[model samples]
Each structure stands twice: as C-alpha cells, then as structure tokens.
Target chain A: MTDALVLLVVVPIAASLFPVALGGRFERIGWFVAAAMGLVHLGLSATVAAQVLESGVISYAVGGFEPPFGIELVADGVSAPLLVLVSLSTLGVLAYARRAGPHSNAFYSELALLTAGISGVFATADVFNLYVFLEITGLATYALVASGRSPRAALASLKYLFVGTIGASLYLLGVGYLYIMTGTLNMADLTGAVASVGYTSPAILTSFGLIVTGLLVKVAVFPLHTWQPGAYAESPDTVSAYISALVSTAAAYALVRIIYAVYTTKFLDEISLAGDALVALASVSIVVGAVLAVMQSDLKRMLAYSSVSQFGLVVAAIGLANETALVGAVVHLVGHAVMKGGLFLTVGVFATGLGVRTVEDFAGLAAKAPISSAAFAVLAFSMVGIPPAVGFVGKWNIVVGAVEAGAWSVAAVVVVSTLLTLAYFGRVIERMYFTAPEPEADAVSTDGGNDAVEVSFGMRAVVVVSAVAAVVLGVLGSDLITVIQPALEVYF
Target chain B: MIDLLTTHYNYIASILLFGIGLYVVMGSPNLVKKIIGMNIFQVGIFLFFVTTGYVDGGAPPVVGHGEETFVSPLPHVLILTAIVVGVSLTAVALALVIRIYDGYGSLDEDVIKEVQVDD
Candidate 1:
C-alpha cells in the first residue's frame, strides 16, 4: 500500500526543481537539497526493499489508477535491491562530491533528475514509460557530462548525446512495433501479447533486433562503445563515477526486465537465435573490452572499457538463461557498480590531490598517496576476481551456471574473463607497489611547498568504504540471494 | 509492385527518411548537419508510430456520443512526449556544438579531433 515506489522517483525530481525555482534567495542550494533528498530517498528505498522482502511484490499504480491503463511501479526481489543500490550510490556520490565538488545548484539538480530517471527505469512496468525515463536519464547524463568546464567535456558529451539518441530512438521504434502488434503498453500484458503474436513472426523479430540493439548501444557493447571512453575520460571525476556506476547498470537492468518479463523464457525457447546472439556478443565484449582496457594509458578510459567487459559478463549470464546465472548477473551488476565506482573515486582523489590522470602517472603511487593507492588496489583486486570479494562470488556463480547449462564456450569465457581482468588491473597495481617514486615532483604538483598531497578525509573515506563493501557485500552474497530468490522465482 | 508501394507507402517513406538521416549523420563532417540528421531520424520514427495508428477512414481519436470507432490515440500521445524529448536533445546538441566551435574555431569533428590531438 506504500506509495514509496512512485515517491522514489517523485521526491528527487521534486527536490531537483527547488534549487532552480527557489535558489535565488538562498546561496549555494544544490548540495544541501541533493544531500537531504538523497537521505530521504535512501530511507524510502530501504523501506520499499523491506516491504518487498516481507510481502512479495509491492506495486503502486500511479494516481491509484489500476494498472494496464495507468503506469504501475513495482518493487520486488528483482527491483528492490537495485532500487536501494541506485539511491545508496547516489547518496555515496553526493558525499564524495560534497568536498570534491562542482557543487553548483544546476549540477545537483541534474544529478537529482538522473536519480529520479534511474529509479523510474527500475520501477516502471510500462514499456513506453521506460523509454521516457531512459531518455530522461540520457538527457540528464549528457548535460552532466558537459557540466565539466572544458571543451573536450562538451565534445564528449555531444558524442554521447548523438549515440544515446539513436539508441533510444531504436528502442522507441521497437516499442512502436510492439504496440502495433500487441496494442498494450504494460509489460505484464505485453508478455501475454508477445506470446500470442508468436515469437517467430517478422514483427516480433524486428522488435527484438531494434530493442536489443538500442539497449546494447546504451550498455556500450563492443563496437557500439565508441562514445563511452571519451565520455568517461573527459567528464569531471565525480560525474563520471555517478554515471559509470548507475547509468549502464540501469540499462542492463532494463534488458533483464525486457528479456525475462516482457518476452519471457517462452520467447527464448522459440527463438534461440536471440539468446545465442546475445551470448556471442557478450563473449566478444568480455574479451575485447579487457583488451581495450589493457591498451589504454588513460586511467578513466581504461575503467570505462572495463565496464564494457563487466557488463559483458552480466549480459552473458543473462544469455546463459539459468537460475544461477541470472542471479549471478544481478550480483555482478551490483558488484561491478561498487568496485568500479570506488576505483573512479580513488582516481579522482589521485587527480585532485596529486595530478595523476594517466596510468604512467600512477608510478610510485604507494609512496606518495598510500591510502588512495591502497583503496585502488583493493577495488582492483576485487575487480580482478579475488576470492571472498564480491567480484569473485559473482564470477563463480556465472561460471558455475554456464557449466551447468553445458554452454562450455560461455563457461570458458566467464572463467577466462578473470585472467583478462587481471591483465589490465595488474599493471596499475604493479606500478603502484613495485615502482619507485620520482622525487620532488609530487610535492610541487599538489602544493607549492614540501608537504604531502591534500587528499580530503571524505575522499579517503568513500574509497575505503567502497573497498570494504566490495568484500563485505561479497560475504553477504548468500543473504542477497535469499532476498533475490522470491523475485527470481516469479520472473522465471 | 505498384500496389505494395501505394498501400504501404507511409512505411516506405518512413524507412527512406530514416536511411537518409542515417546517411547524413554518418557521412557528414559538419556537426550541425549531424544534429539535423538526428532530428530527421527522430521525425522519421515518429511518422512510423503515427502510421501504425492510422485506420482506414477513422476519425481523429475523438470520442463522440455513441461512437463505436476511432484511431488509436496511444501512439500519438507517446510520440508527443518523444517529440519533446527530441527537442531537448537538439537543444543540448547545439549547445555543445557551439562550445566546440568556440574552443577550436571549427564545427568539423575531424578538425576538432586534429586540434585536440595536437594539443
């Protein structure tokens, strides 16, 4: 009976408008408003998760208009964790941004809007509403990427804009076909409609191609990932962390939704090519993304490409189409968000305090900025699939699931992906610990005197906290599975 | 052939429009032209949705007293929202193009890339 699901989106959006509409009287309104609303949002999403855990799925129809006619917001085992993750990460990024900040009211507004859009993407049950929210997320992302006061950031943002628009448009076209064929916009209704229309129809085939391609572009799969590196590399560190953690995570979530909910396992049973192509594509992304990550000298760009690969694993798990793998996909999604985002924040600390933006610049990082370097090492190892870390748990589930399914090739890729991950992250770790510092350079760059770099307490805490969560959440994966079991059973 | 062309001409036109837009977006070097192409692409997709709702001789989705039939209004409403989203995208794209032109004195992405490389 709680409207928490709707308010999950509405609260942030409502707060987002305040800094713009009423900020003239108040000075520096963005961070306060964002932080306050973020806290409320975190609490609310936690409540929603608790409710969903106790009572199956919690569905809130907008304006109390019964579903199928009006939009319905559902929080179940599937969406509840992601809802908490989205709000929690938004608040975390806000905390990191508090000290390391663009701190403008407009920036906070866009961040809030992005939060709202992501929550909507997670909660909405209607296909068209997903598109609207997707665009909202994209639009907010482009503006936020451009919020960095540099020309390259603008260019990168523009590039992201064009690619993202096409991706979204293709999705809209898919929806058009779906509507034309089925005449219902609701996801649950579409599941029945799609089956009744038959899985192998030309229209259904076209819808699949357009819809999956559209989402793949957003997810930044293999060749479609051109805009990603530039966008991640050029944006301000905080903004990159926010988008990197949430944007594609939400997109991947949508893909899982459409595959499991709208199309259903029945669709996969009929058109095996859909699942096969996804597996093939994700495997390619896994290998190629790691290769690209190894090739990049730019640290943020490397992280961006790593994301392409991590998401590849999730996509592949979904492609595997088993109970264990699907759960593995969800775990990996959350694991990557925590580890990758923490990596970005640590990099931000490196850049702000020590002017280290490139991999080569990370030389002797342990000697100068030990805390940040240590935090980076922890996240990097977690990302490299160190056992007992959440990353390892996710990889293990996917590999085991792939093996159980007798998809030997997919299983091999899921296993080999660990070594591929290490190949890139290993270099950074090596540089940090094994190399000697170039003396007199570090002290001059951060401050004009002979003093250590000024890495803020907040910056250090966030990095440490995420590194800690990377391990702690891993140990709690079994608990996570219990919470997710109900949602998984219903979807399957 | 002629029968297929006329009855499904709207779909054909929409596809053609999309192809043209795609070509312009991919082929052109001018950043603004790319944005224009993007706009055309969106409008093309909008037409595709509108065409789906078109019923033979059905009145505009208005409900009159005891009326039994009308065109589907759902896609139309969806497209309206999409059109607004499209507009905002264009605005942001133009703003970015302006900033790039200001920074590098060129709207050609190749030239901008070159300058960025040199820097």
Candidate 2:
C-alpha cells in the first residue's frame, strides 16, 4: 500500500508496451488488456487516496535515496482526489472506447502511456520530473489526436506538437533558472530556498513569469489557445473526452501546486504584481472565452472554448491565494473535469446515434435520443451553476473568496461567467427541447451509409454516471474541503 | 555594459541563440524550418543549463582525482537527459512534418492552409 504511488505510474507505463508486443494472435486483446490494467490502476490509486486521507502526506524516496538528493513521489490531500479523478476519468473513457473506437493495439498502448504520464505529473515531488512527465503527456496526446482518420487530424496534431513543445521548453528554462538560484529541484526544498533568496530578486521574478506563462499555454487560456478547438474537434470522440477532462485539468493543478507549494503566498504578498497580473489575465479569458463559445457554430468547438472560460475560474481562484479560494480551485478542477468530460461524451452519443454534430442539427434532439438529451441537459445545467450542482458549489466558493479578498472586479467577473455560460448552453438547450427537428434530417447522414448507427450501452452509461457524479459531488463539496483542509494548512 | 557582457558571455550567447530560434519559429512559414528552430531553441536552453555548473579551474567530476575543486556534475547529468528528450522530440516533430508533406503535398504553412480551405 505504501508503494502504491510509484506503482500507479510504473504499472501503466510497463503495461503499455505489452499491448504493442502482443502482435499477431493477441491483437484484439488490447482493449481487454487496457481495461484490466485500468482496473489495477483504479485499485492502486484508491489505496493511495485512502491512505492519504487517513494519514498525512505520504512521501516515498526512489530506490531508498533520501531527501533533497533523490526523486520523491508524494500523495497529499490536494493530489489524492486528483489521483482518483485521473484513474476514474481514464477508466470511464476506456469503457466508452470499447464500443466506439479505432480499437487498434497501438491506440490502447498510447492510452495507457497517457495514463502513466498524467499519474506521474500528479505524483512527482521534483520539478524536473514534472517537466519530463509533462512532455510524456504532451507526446501521448499528440499521437492520440492524430489517430483520427481525417488528414485534418494530422494538421491539428502537428500544430499542437509545435506549440506544446514550446510550452514545455519554456517551463524547462524556468526550472534551469530556479536551479541556478536555489541549487535544488525538489519542491519542498525549493520552498525554503526561494524565500531565502527574496521574492523581489529579478531572477525569481523572471523564473516565476516564465513558469506561469508556460503553464497557462497548457491550461489553454485565451489568445494562447489557438491549437485547442481544432484538436478537440478533429480527434476521435473518445480522445476528445479523455484529454479534455484530464490534460488541462492536470496543468491547472500543477499551476496551483507551483504557486502555493513552491513560491508560497508570501511571494504573492511581497510581489503584488504577479498575483494581480494572473487575475487580470484570467478575467480577460473568462469574458473572451464565453463570447467565443457563443460565436462557434460547431458543437465540439464551442465546448473547447467553454474549457478556456472554465479554467479561467480555476486560475482566478489560484491567484486569490487564500484557503477558501485554493479549496475552490481544487473543487472546480474536479467539477469541470466531470461536467466537461460528460458533455463531450454526450456529443459523441449524438453524433454516433442521430448523425448530429452541429448546434443546428440538435434541434429537437430530445425526440430521437430522449435519454441522452436529458443527460446532456442535466450536465449543461450543472455547468451553468444551477443550485445543488457541482458547478454552482465551485463558483459560489470562488465568488465569496474573491469578495472576502476585496477583489471586487474578479468577483463580478466570476458572477458574470455563470450567465455567459448559460448564454451558449442555453442556445443548445433551447434548440434541443423547444425547437422542432427539420423534415429532411432523415437524409442528413453525413457518412452516406445506410448501416445502423448504434449508441453503445457503455457510452451512455458513462455520460449518465458523470451527470450523477456532478450533482452528488455538489452536495459533498463541503466534505471535500474538510478532506483538503490539512493540505491547505501547509500552504497558508 | 562591456564588463557585464565579457563576464557573462556564455549567458548572453545562450539567450541570443534562444531569441534567434524563437524568431525563426514564429517567422518561418515552412514546417521543417519551424522544427529546426525548435531544436535550436532547446539546444540554447541546454547550453544555459550546462554552463551554470562551470567553475573557473575545476576538474571534471570524476572522483579519486585528489582534486579539491570539481565542477558540479548534476547540471551535466541533467542536460544529458534533456538532450535525449530533445532528440526524441525532434524525431517526433520530423515524423509529423513528413506526414504533413505527404498529406497536403506542401511543407509551407500558407500552402497547407490554402489546401485545407479548398477541401
């Protein structure tokens, strides 16, 4: 059980190679292998989460090397829930892919590799190890995005590779700067070292600037988010849901970790420009992302834009740098993952069953796919911050935290974001329930095939389960804060 | 200004290399050139990292040399791993570039955009 943190990363990475190695006779067994491994990952992460919640932070030195000299894996209060989220979300997507998939051995291999990479990002206590994991995650994602049949998938993947590599490189440079200043890469050691060097030093300022900017690109903030809409829209539906749920969420979590764990809030208090700049940027992203989402014609593109806006809320919470806001960041990170992942899977259901891909095609979709439409409506309303939903709980905490911090503008922007969320989602909901389906929609099958379009049981179950989890998580939001309170105590 | 440049010439050179790489990546239209630019940019960072470990007259970090002064081997080991990562990244980027060329019959970003629009 103590070794669960390292096993959570190593098991999937080692298993990833097996799928590709099992060539001729065992080709079709890849999904089964991946599924079994997913279960193992779930068990391991659940053990880690239980142990972490019961005790305090669990730290393991690699190969018995101790302290600042060796790489360490940590399972703390903040990372414990995220570890479970990574396992559950990936397992959920794997189930969906069982029915709707490319289903090749190589595809499953990439999926397993991606799981290992994300788990590594969450587990590592070393800054440079985080970079290596970030690159691993980026590499796996690019290949999965390009797994789509269209040539456009190739284009999107390449663009993402270029931009994503640059982002990671910038982060590496920041690490180099820190190493020069503090002579250590361990997160815990850097905390003390950074404070000793003084926050007003130019080297510290530059390093913080580069690190935050690099991560914001990965988080897909507006203006730095050109690669996202195309990648999400062009990839396979399973890929879209998996990456949308985990990738940017992992980056946002890393940002929060870097801000609170490494730099600490004292740096923000001393250098007020840094925190104010983050809040300002996040505020702009909030308004711009919603407006862009409203203007998008394609359903997947709109959802991609919606992520930009949602992450703005998470980043804003991080910038507020108080216990309430920090807890809100963690809550929103999990909430957004469940809601957005569910929304993407629902989009896939519509596309697979009724040949619907655009907002216009969704007119009276309730008649054809009653179950999916209901699930979609529930998830969408949850995203719009209706009371008793996870989205409302997250946004409420952030708004109150901002108000307490006396950042009135940020509080106002967060409130306005709820209505803006309603703006784009409301259009879809209206077309879904209120408007009538077109007469010629029967002939509108874009694939030009007469074969039956089946919506798999696994796919629908995942979407419906996500909606249930969203509302259930909302009611349990306070419990989440209580669990994470110990971790917040270490920070503030 | 001259004293600063002379004293930290390695840092200045690395930053300049990084700047040039960024300019090429953002300015060039060809996909292959963009990837080459990425490599240059990464090498620049590697140089900066490796140079940070250099001491004036310190020997290489092989133990039992009976030398009191030794250049820090940590950054060297780090850059070695970084170099491996850079090579793999370059290989993947080139593979992606080949696929783009095969699919669109062009390596230029502008031409690819026009081809996509026509499709």
CAPRI accuracy category, model 2: medium
Model 1 C-alpha lDDT per residue in residues A1-492, reported as the tens digit of each score: 477888999999899998777678876888899999999999999999989988988888888789898888888897899999988798889889888887678899999999999999999999999999999999999999998988999999999999999999999999899999999989988989999999988998899899989999999988898999889889888999999998999999999999899888878877888899999999999999999999999999999999999999999988877888899899998899899889999999888887877787777889888877888998999998898899988888898989888889998987788898998999999988997766665555556423243567877899999999999999998998888866877666
Candidate No. with top TM-score: 2
List ranges where model 1 is wrong by over 4 Å.
Answer: A440-454, B65-67
lDDT of 2 by residue, A359-440 (tens): 9989988987898899999999999999798998889888988988999999999889989999999999999999998777
Proportion of true contacts reproduced by candidate 2: 0.39
lDDT of 1 at A490: 68
Clashing residue pairs in all predictions, respectively, total 0, 0
Q: What TM-score does prediction 1 earn?
A: 0.97
Candidate 1: DockQ?
0.90
Off by over 4 Å in 2: A446-453
Q: What TM-scores do the predictions have?
A: 0.97, 0.98
**lDDT (Cα, tens digit) per residue for candidate 1, span B24-53:** 888999999999999999999999998898
